[model samples]
Target: MVPKVPIDLPGTRYHKARVAADALRQQLTQIIEERRIALRNGRASAEQDLLSFLLSNGSDEEERGLTDDEIKDNIILLLYAGHDTSSSTLTSLFKFLAENPHCYDQVLREQLKVASSKEEGELLEWKDLQRMKYTWRVVQETLRLLPPAQGGFRKAIKDFTYSGFTIPKGWKAYWTVNATHFNSKYFINPKKFDPSRFEGAGPAPYTFVPFGGGLRICPGNEFARVEILVFLHNVLKNFRWNLVDPDEKIIIDPMPLPLKGLPIKLIPHSK
Candidate 1:
């Protein structure tokens, strides 16, 4: 059985977590310092990446800029949020595709159609991204099943009643994506993996929120979509792989990850 103690409790796990966190903080500080130097040398542009954007001059004199520590904090947030979510989504997606070969073939066919339209050695552009309909549907289905951000928190702006409970002002509100994803009212056979659910207008506005919704919707949603699709296009076009341990289970220590780290055997595609 797993230990049921809180993370803050003094224990080996807590010590390890603290050490890992400090190491990560150090690394991020180093990266922030390097970017500051690059900016000083004019080797990097303000519009380049998230780091550059944060380090850029404010739009107007009234706009205050971020401190070096603040910039590092934002970098840590993105590195923590953006990296794991996409990586986990991709891992789960590939696992699903490998298990469902028919879906894999369908996705492969659609991707190949997109590939044929592009010139040799040319990179995918906005048009290519728009054409990846089926693949995106598959991605949606995967996200619904195993959202990287299982849920998030929001602070109540004022006193309100929800589901008959009077929530006082200053209380925190939480929403779980699973509530909708697993509900029969919102999904037909919620347990089944049906990409068709996303074929048309898809689930109602807030009902299928793998990436939260409304004002707090993930700012990087489009970036994540482009990143995942581009990755799929490249990998599926050049290689195929089989799971080394088909029976491996997914666990959520904090983020969803295959218990065995998703070991696989790669097979290169013939030209």
Candidate 2:
């Protein structure tokens, strides 16, 4: 959880954060205005992207369009959801793979088998990603160990009882990823880096929720899986790397990160 700071405290990190946020808001406002002008001039298509779609479809016969503030807020949310989380997960994946040589070898072998079936210099396709079962399992294990977002805030829709405790309706709750991911009831020997846990039926439903669950689950989960797998396949096909600091500490400042930014010495495969 991110600790709250006094935003009014001058020269503090919180002050800097506020300044940066203001600057970003200004930038987004400018971009939105420019896009609005472009849309009016017929220089941009309404179907181009989410921003364009929102701009185009927001207004209707009886409803008003989203305000600039609303659009900026949503854009920020998407930026973090679609980009930051995946990057953090990828960072943790590299660290885990490097530490577990056996697991790394298995991932490399699986990725290579998929590559072998493709023509040289060919790009990976959806079917190719589908074939990377073991690699995806390894990624799942990594997520179990270190989920980027940790948890999220949710409100109870109705009173519910679990473990003899009653959560009253209208109460806010935070569901932690590690709480379930690390529970021995859901995972055997939870601390161990074993991807085989995902084999067959996998963990009980809602037990392994790195992308959240139910209606509130992240929409980009599949996209992130494809992104991570494709990146790993390409990197493993051409290079092997060793961490410069084998025992580097992982610190979570909202999201997990290697203390040293995970410097590595890459060893390219000989042609």
Candidate 3:
């Protein structure tokens, strides 16, 4: 989803937003300072009552800056994403590599072509990432097949019609993404994790949005992609991993989460 278009803010809306922003700046500054002090002095400064002022009204504007509650909320939301969402994607990748051992060889081949034997070359960077076209393709395919948000709920404020069904105002709509992915009308074999499905495949104009569609889509979709690619490429390169879990137990039915929270063990790989 792109940045929302500018709209006239109601008086209440603007006031509430400003209020939230101010509070966030103070909260973030407190946390950052608390961590810094803890690092240097081995504890937080009890002389400062940061949390107390936070509940009331705290503004350290000239020094630290205005509170961006929007930014603060986003940062907290990202914690769950960075951990839970990533864990799900990695678990899927490990499961695939475990079942199909040959995929590891394929990944290794791709890495060898992209890196130098030098120590510095092994360290990944944003620019270095461009070389791994195959890795990107596979991750894209994986996300398409098993999006972290398998589905979502949306409520209609006004009446709307989708397909033959009419959703009146004040009704909840549950949008299904995983169902869309399995449509054979699009993919020849929708169930398979074949990276070739996306090879040179420019996005077709339609609603296959795994992240979501319309307002309130996940903001960290691209960030998650980069994170997964870097994590997968490095981990798979440095160590070999195997899944001791069986396929039938994977339970892909409930959201993007694995049924059993996949348990895999990794062993170091020799170059």
Candidate 4:
């Protein structure tokens, strides 16, 4: 997407984004300093979590240890890639399920089957998530239709030709996820929402990449999967919802978002 203003002019989206970024960086810096102090004071354990681990092991004497800024940047990336993207996918999933009753029913049935197998008040485990094939297919379809990230930028490894166009070895290229996702060559009736597309062999090797492909692919992809499936399982098992506006418009500010935040009326399942 292109910025409306060349500079961070007042009252512009670019300026607002800069303000938010600065606030986030400041907040993360404070948290990092507090954690570092706690670690030095023996008030926190190095094994507590990722932040603590990074702080504990980051020694200036070691050549490979991450700098404070590096640690902060990594944390920011994880928050956006792991948290924001998952939230977007979940929101879109809810909207789609509400619009398509048949798909909603199938997802509910699949989730209930998984729930029924668990003991009362039992927590969902990794293996339980693995059994949620159909539910995941639904999620996959959601990702395909409304990927959290529109796409990413990559550099050409070497000169290559595709569709008779030659790309230079070092030129930076931008790829759009929707373009690949909506291609009829890779997907049948690409505009249609079909979870069955992921049934067997799934979309071709590099085609179904909500998470980018190859070594540069998202590292938090599996974490997002578990997070999404677990949330869907619990929510579907306990509640039924209907979209307040079935025809809500999706707009991409950066990622796809409902114009009205996907307003919904939730009905709790009867005990």
lDDT of 1 at 86: 96
lDDT of 2 by residue, 1-271 (tens): 7866476788988888778878888998888888878988999899988888878877332278887778787888888889999899888898888899899899989988999999988899999999999999999999999899889989999999889989999988888898899999999899999999999999999999999998999899999998999888888998878899998999888899889999988888783
Alpha carbon RMSD to native, model 3: 10.3
lDDT of each: 0.87, 0.89, 0.67, 0.89
Off by over 4 Å in 1: 1-9, 12-15, 30-45, 58-63
lDDT (C-alpha) at residue 259 in model 4: 94
Clashing pairs for model 4 are: none
TM-score of each: 0.88, 0.92, 0.67, 0.92
Model 3 lowest lDDT segment of ten: 50-59
| Ranking 1 against 3 by TM-score, winner | 1
| Evaluation by TM-score, superior candidate among 1 and 2 | 2
Model 4 clashing-pair count:
0
**Local accuracy of candidate 1 as per-residue lDDT tens digits, 9-59:** 556788787787779879977887787779879999988998878877641
**Residues 60-87, model 3: lDDT tens digits:** 3324533545335545556555667777
Q: Tell how far residue 94 is off in model 3, in angstroms.
A: 0.9
What total of clashing residue pairs does each candidate reach?
Answer: 0, 0, 3, 0
How far residue 35's Cα lies from its native spot in candidate 3, in Å, is 9.6
- In candidate 2, position 238 carries an lDDT of 84
Residue 150 of model 4 has an lDDT of: 84
Candidate 4 ranges beyond 4 A from true positions: 1-6, 59-62
Candidate 2 lDDT score at position 169: 99
TM-score of 2: 0.92
